[model samples]
Target chain A: MKIKTFLAFVGPSVLAMVGLIAVPLIGVVYLSFHSSYVKTEIVEVKSSVPLFGGLTKTTVEKVPQPVLDENGEPVKVWEYVGGRNFDTVADPGGLVAAVSKDRSTTEDGQPTSFRQRMDGLYRDVTDIDFWGALEFTLLYAFITTPCILVLGFLLAVLVNSVVQWIRGPLIFATLLPFIITPVVGSLSIYWLFLDNALVASLLEQFGAGKIYFLKDAISIRTLIVLYGVWHVTPFAFVILYAGLQTVPQDALQAAMVDGATYWQRIRYIIIPHLRALFSFIILIHLMDAYRIFEPVLVFGSNLFANSLQYLTYYILNFEDNYYKAAASAILTVIGICILLLPVLRRTYREQKGVA
Target chain B: MAMTRDEKFWEGMRWAGFGATFLFMAFPIFWMILTSFKVARDAYSTKVFFSPTLNNFISIFQDPYNFGPLLFNSVVVSFSTVAVAIPAATCAAYAFSRYQFKGKNALMVSVLSSQFVPPVVVVLPFFILFKNLHLLDTRLALVILNLSFVLPFAVWMIKGFIDALPPDIESAAVVDGCNRFQVLRHITLPLIMPGVVTSAVFGFIQSWNEFLFALILTNQKAVTLTVGLMGLHTDKGILWEHMAAASMLIMIPIFAISFTIREYFISGLTMGAVK
Candidate 1:
């Protein structure tokens, strides 16, 4: 192909991505450096008003921006704080420094105990809320990825085994969770356990007392993971089932002719055949689950069970701290990158081996 | 044919598992649809059967929760995204499928990995830019952002289809003195029509169901249906019936579309990884 033709073909999508995705990504990294804080600086501004009879009035209004102080000064400022925004959520050294700065205020101030120092540090720098979300984010990613993989693979095998006539209906039914909107899907699961809901009533009848699924952190976390699996497994199933189609018929038939049990055949043949698909699924899940947000939004309140995505969002939405939100957003990217390294390394090695 | 005891036992177990899977998948959506048809009082209770009324659907559309605009926004944004993305993606996909260029693998990986970046990271910049341009709450801004998402997947997916198609016909067309563009128009496009439709449908679904972009980019005027469901919250508590009604409206069209393209679901989703 001519270079011009190639560019013509590839240019629009690339430009769209660069303008929309790449530039914005660079913006997040750039915004992470400058801290938004209240600063007091006097500034002047021009103003204009349309008066009666098509006349215009222009005046310098004393617009006291929040970065400026009282004397018609700006009170808020975008201070270039370097990585200080990152220290708010992470930065143990910064936490210690914050504690040391406030040691005099630590409970009577006479050689504060370790616990007191830690508590003070938590207050000063370590946002427990963000850390809590980080913890749950990891937990959700690990727990739900495995659950969805297992269920999806299982369901795919079952669906393939079913009578051919029913396959279409079965596939549509299985994909329902995936097709439903994520927020609404999570709400459906949450609503199932609502007071006087069918599941709640059934649990009572089953001698397990009506459990308040939402209020209890453990149950809510489980509910969120369950909902994740319910929503994502279908995608995995579709992928894995497609992989299964590529399984060598001769090999399967040979194994079937022998006395190999179903489980044995799956373990020895199907699993190995699915190794590439498994890796792809893992990469997708890790990339997705590390940035978990919708479940937290729909199932758990940001007050208690925020994901890392939610943590960044809370910083932006409530605190309106763009710099801090950027820092958190960058941190989230790093977390996902860390999770992605092993899978990427494996793919690289496989490519080299192929070469 | 005489079945052994072991075979009979396995048959029952398999059917049981299938039944369980089916119920698990279908029940939540079934409940959503069922609840939307119930009256306010009966909606709350765990009653097996409630007098079905079409009131929830009618009420939500009429009153404060005017979903007509939201639905229109969704349709416009989704269809527009597909319209722009499909052709652009097909071009890129054709390039990837036909040519072996420098940095081709890297470019493909870049497309794949774009999916990994959290929407929050991307939304952050778009929000500021849109605010600066006074384009916030505009469907145009939403469409512009939606392109970033739909383009990559569409490119990769259509590339899969074009790759699977034999190059023999195109080569013959070239031998007949047809240029690349003519060959693409007369042969390549007609051949890849199913793949195009599949990519278009997949892109539409992704754009339609996208929540964060819709939630953040647009507000009252340009609310898409997914985030519009969240707006149904009232001061007292969640208006469950109305939300159910709204949820159904958002999902039923997706269900119809998905069922129509059920055969492509596996291939379109996997982007030809399995095939």
Candidate 2:
């Protein structure tokens, strides 16, 4: 009786998720293999004479090519030849024939050629552009994660010491950077740092030439890292600030009473207590950073500085290569899974009470 | 008795450190707002504290393809996503919190893990799915996609909120001959109202600020503010003044929401995952 009730309750949600989420997810997997094709249909009219020389007509038929392939061979094929409208047939002893070609079949009516089965899974995993984008994505994530963590920790520590009256406004001010959309954020950075702008102007004042933020590979990469750090650090700060608030005051007092230095108290009392929040924030940021798209797209709006995420966007939007884009996206998912494996495993075990 | 000079010196250093940190954190936003009011020429000048002008604001609004529709799109998609997501999540969350059932733990974990799935991973597949369904380029398509991200977080948050509520209140209603629907409407919903609001606000902000999905799923009619901002960086040059105006527009709603529900936003960030 309990089992039936549970099934009834869970059934709809499971079905909805499967139908809306899982089926499309599966379709993405399917589309990664099959090439997207466009089909055009044309009809031709023909005229012929009946046996009694009375007027009769027949519709000529032609199929351009196979719609679907079987074992990598065209299951249906057609031969089409061009001619002037009814001119050849009007001439004496003129004839028209529609022919078909099956490349897999030999002249002796034997299937001599071997065709390979469609390996969608293998192709989805092995696309070249996908791998390049994967590498760039990892590098971006790795570089930015630590920067945000350290900067956030430092900011949180500083905020923790502010007077009660000022803390509220100060906290909100610090959070403003993160509240804006990343698209705007990256554009702002681009405007500031692009050639002859504020950053370039400042550099030029110091005897430096105008800096092209997105021109060179190294600078563009650097810009992306900086942008990622700038955009994401506020999120880390918010989480760390909350975590800092929860640190036991008594423990800090005890450490101070033991004549430990400020840094020492932070290292032992504050850091240890904030481990779960730190891990949670880090995991979230890492996953988010790995999929860095908008900033890269906004800042590196051009051909160069295309990070893996941006590359995926370029492929999907510019190239219109859905199969390759799907491959890249799949790789990105795998990269995130690998990065998050430790935290996910820990959560799984804790939930299951296995450790 | 002697006063220690070292202690005073360290206190002074702490104050200096805080001032520097505050300045660092606050300057970008200060600059953003400052640039929004400057004329195009004055914006490029390095001199500080110039007379401010409203030219940027005027230009942003007077222009044909200004921030108007993009802002409207953001508002519509965000609120629509929140409206759909919150109710669906509330139902699922209530079941998870109140009922003890098989696959309960698994379902929760799956929902949580969905948050970890990179948006890039789903974009391509979702693009194909939407295209096949003829949902591409529609506002409804964006709302549906946003829900996938927003719904999980909403569910997790509402579940946490519901878990914090006392079950005895509902039990009393049950004892008074209330059916499940009546008890939920009269008792549970009212009790967890704050949680619902918090979840809705969070979902709205997330969907509003979400750029990746919006950049991919939307074009032309449904072009959101975020994607529209990207247009500022064309081949001609980066339009700092116009971009700043747009940035200011996007930040206003999010800042308002964050400030209003400051405590709930903090709690919602940590949610059940941390504590």
Candidate 3:
């Protein structure tokens, strides 16, 4: 292909990507350091009140009102506030103060030891909203990654061992959870655990007391992680199952002849065979679990637990401040890049080799 | 081969695991389908038996919970996004596969890296831009915003398919007095038609299932089905059966499309990573 031809074919997509993605990324970074506000001024007005007779009384009060242009839209002012939005969103000073205060003394003002100081550091970091959200998001990603991989591998093995006729239905059953819309999937699970719903009622029927699963931080976080694993494990299963079809049957036969146990074969042959797919799943899962937004909304877990994406969203939508939201969003992006650095480097090397 | 006692034990365990896995994976969906048909009173219970009714579905489509417009918006937005993304992606994928152009690797790497950017980063600026342009709450806004992720995905997926092709057919067409355009149109397009369709379906699902962009960019006139789920949270409390019914509406089309393309779905998902 000529260079012109290649450019002609690729131009539109490159343009769209640059216009939509690259430009917006730069804009987000720019907005993080600046804020737009409606210009306002204090104005006083007096209104007369009629008495019973012809006399009247007047009073004046001042109020801050947005200054409008000739077009009647509010006049806007743009100002740069370096790191203020970041500070507002992260509360870093508060975090440092909390940690230092703990380092010096206990709550009752006694001197603290190293272990106690470490414990207080942990508490202080989590108490700050941004650090707490990062902790939960990372924990969710790490916990769900292994669970999904193991369960998914086991599922692949079971499906591979099953009769051919049942495999289709089994795949269908597994794909339902994976393919269902995330919000709907999370909502379905959330409905079952509601106080009067099926799961809660079943627990009570089995002699447990009434439990408010959604009310507590621990249970809600657990449910969120469970939802993550349940929703994503099928994806891993499908990919690994595809990998399984390529595993050499002769190697398995040799293992069987050598009196290898099932677990031993899985540990030695199947795992090493599917190692690439494992990393693929982990890479995708980490990227996704960091942006765990819909479940946080559907499960109403924001009051108890917030993912980094959810915090950005809460600031963007509920607080309706783009600057702070952009600051939070930039931090979230940095976190993902850090989390994915190793996998991404490995992938880049492999792609370069292939090229 | 005949099964020994140990083999029999392992087979039994496999069956048990299969059963457990099936129940865990399918039960929530089954419960969803079941509740969508149940009366409001029975929906909150744990009973396996209930007098089911279609009234919940009927009610959701009427009055304040008018899902008809939402359904329309979702279909329009998703289809428009795929229609726009697939062609652009196919062209780019072909270029990347067939040509060794300058800066190709840099461009490809940038495309791939953009996929991992947290969506909120892009959405924040788009939100502000769309607000300034008064494009909020329009299906067009959604279609354009969705391309940020969908185009990259479609490019990588379709490129995977193109790379797998041998290129012999295109060379033959070129030797037989075909220009590059004619060769691509006559030969390569037909060869990669299945890939194109697969990418289309995958892109459609991504667009349909998208939540965050639609959530922030839309309010009233252009709510997609996924965002429309929020409507079920009424002040009277979430009407469970009604919500179930609405969820079915959101899920049924995706379920249908996925089942038909089950074979391609896995390949499309792993195409970027594997290749």
Candidate 4:
């Protein structure tokens, strides 16, 4: 009876998840393997109109359109004659050979091996959307994660006080950066580096000329990494601050009485006590950061700072390339899963005991 | 909490640091507000002082931008998501919290892990599905997409809250000839109302701030405020003052909501992490 009732209670949620998320995800994988195809279809066209003659012009013609299936559906039809979409992205020229410089020394003045030619091809390749995006994604994740941890720790420690006079407003102030839309929040940072803005003016005052931070690829990437740290630190600060409250005061007092400085007490008692909290924070941050998107949009770094998520959007929106988009989306999902494996393992271990 | 001479020095230094940190934190918002009020000619200048005008606000609400529909869409989408997701999440959360069914752990783990899947991956299938159904540019699409993220978060958070409620009340109602439905309606719902509200607010904000899915799913008619802010970037370069005004309008309500619900904010965000 309880089992029947439980299913009734939970049925809607499970149904919704299975319908939207699970089914679509499976569809993503299925669709990724099949590329779009255009099949010429014969069609009958008839038209009548009054023309120069009183007989009224009449036209009948057979035209060709893309073929539809039995259900009048296009079926994507699986095309690779133009090019395999996924290969153009994830494995561009994977099976091809090309030389760099065309001047490499050889007795016959020709490249000797496909392996050498491929190596030179790789050297000559300056940027590709999929690979650059992956690079930016990892760089953003690694740099921002540590920055949030350290900066959030400082903010937490800075504001964690017995004095209530200033804590309230300070907490509210810190929350502003986080509470804004991610697009607008990143834009706020991006705008500051534009010419005639305050930050740019400050740079000019300090013997630097007018500079737009979004101009260069490196600066664009730097702004994104910096924007990420600025945006995510509030979350870390809030979590760590909550964790700090859980520390036992007597332990800290005992350490203080034993001649431990504030730093020493925090290093020994506080950090050790808050280790679980740190792991939880890290887990949340890792999952969120690995799927980073909107910041790249505001940073205007389409040329260099595209994240994997951004690349997925780019593939579909600009390329009109659904086949490759599905493949990239699947690749991104795999990347997220790999990143979260350790966190998932820990959660599974804990849940086993709960069970 | 006793203070010594050395500790006093550190305390003073700490307050000073917080003062600086507070300024750093608040400066962008200060500038945003400052720009919103600045006259157009003075917007690009570095001068801190200028005569202010409210024309930017009124002008943005005029033609070509038409932010009114976008704001309406944001409200409807966010509220509709919370409305749907909250009840569904509550039902699931209650089940997870109250029962020990087989594979309960597995179910919970799967639900929680879904939260980590990037919106882009999710958006891919949604884009195709919505295109076929002619659901694009409708508030329903945003609500449905919002539910994918907000549902997992809401379920986890609501479950955590429900977990803290005492079992005695539920069991007592059950003993008093109450069916599971009756017990949930009579005894459980009232007890967990605060959690439900907190979860609702969190879900609301998640949908409100959601960018990727909305950007892809809606072109003009059902655009949310988060995307509408982008429309301010015209060919004549970004209208800094106009964006500032639009942004302030975008942020103020969420700020008000966050401030009012400030107490439960962290607990809701971290979900079970704090416990």
Writing each residue's lDDT as its tens digit, candidate 4 over A264-318 gives: 9989998888777777777888887877888788776777777888888988899
Per-candidate DockQ versus the true complex?
0.67, 0.42, 0.77, 0.65
Model 3 interface DockQ: 0.77
Docking quality of model 1: it rates as: medium
Query: lDDT by residue for model 2 over B1-275, one digit each (tens)?
Result: 65599978977887887777666556666677778888788877765788888777667666655777777888899989888778777776777778876677787888788776666656677787788898887788888788777888888889889888888878888888886657767998998898889899889988988888888888788888888877766575767877788788888788889999876776776676455
Question: Which regions of candidate 4 deviate over 4 angstroms?
Answer: A41-85, A92-126, A353-355, B1-9
**Sorted on lDDT, highest at the top, how do the candidates line up?**
3, 1, 4, 2
Query: Model 1, chain B: what is the TM-score?
Result: 0.96
TM-score of chain A of each: 0.79, 0.70, 0.89, 0.80
Candidate 1 lDDT, A43-155, residue by residue in tens:
67877799999998999856554553468655555667888888876766754566567564445557877787676665554346666677788888899888888999999
TM-score of each: 0.89, 0.81, 0.94, 0.89
**Which candidate gets the maximum TM-score versus the true structure?**
3
Residue B179 Cα positional deviation in candidate 4, in Å, after optimal superposition: 1.9
Best by the lDDT measure: 3
Q: Compared with the true structure, what per-residue lDDT tens digits does model 2 show for residues A128-219?
A: 34444555677788898889989888888887877878877777777776776777676666666777767788988998876666677678
User: What's the C-alpha lDDT at position B263 in model 1?
Assistant: 85
**Model 3, range A1-355, lDDT digits (tens) per residue?**
8889888989999999999888998999999999988999999988899998899999998989999999999999999999999999889898778766637687788988988888878877888889888988998999999999999988988899878998877887797888899999999889888887889888898999898899888999999998999999999998888889888889999999999998899889988988878888888899999999988998887767789999999988889899999999999998999999998877777677778
Q: TM-score of B chain for each model? A: 0.96, 0.93, 0.96, 0.94
Q: Top model by DockQ, which number? A: 3
Where model 2 places Cα greater than 4 Å from the true spot, the runs are: A1-20, A36-128, A206-210, A301-304, A352-355, B1-3, B233-235
Q: Report fnat in order of the candidates.
A: 0.72, 0.44, 0.78, 0.64
- What does DockQ come to for candidate 2? 0.42
Tens digits of lDDT, candidate 1, B88-108: 898888877787766666677
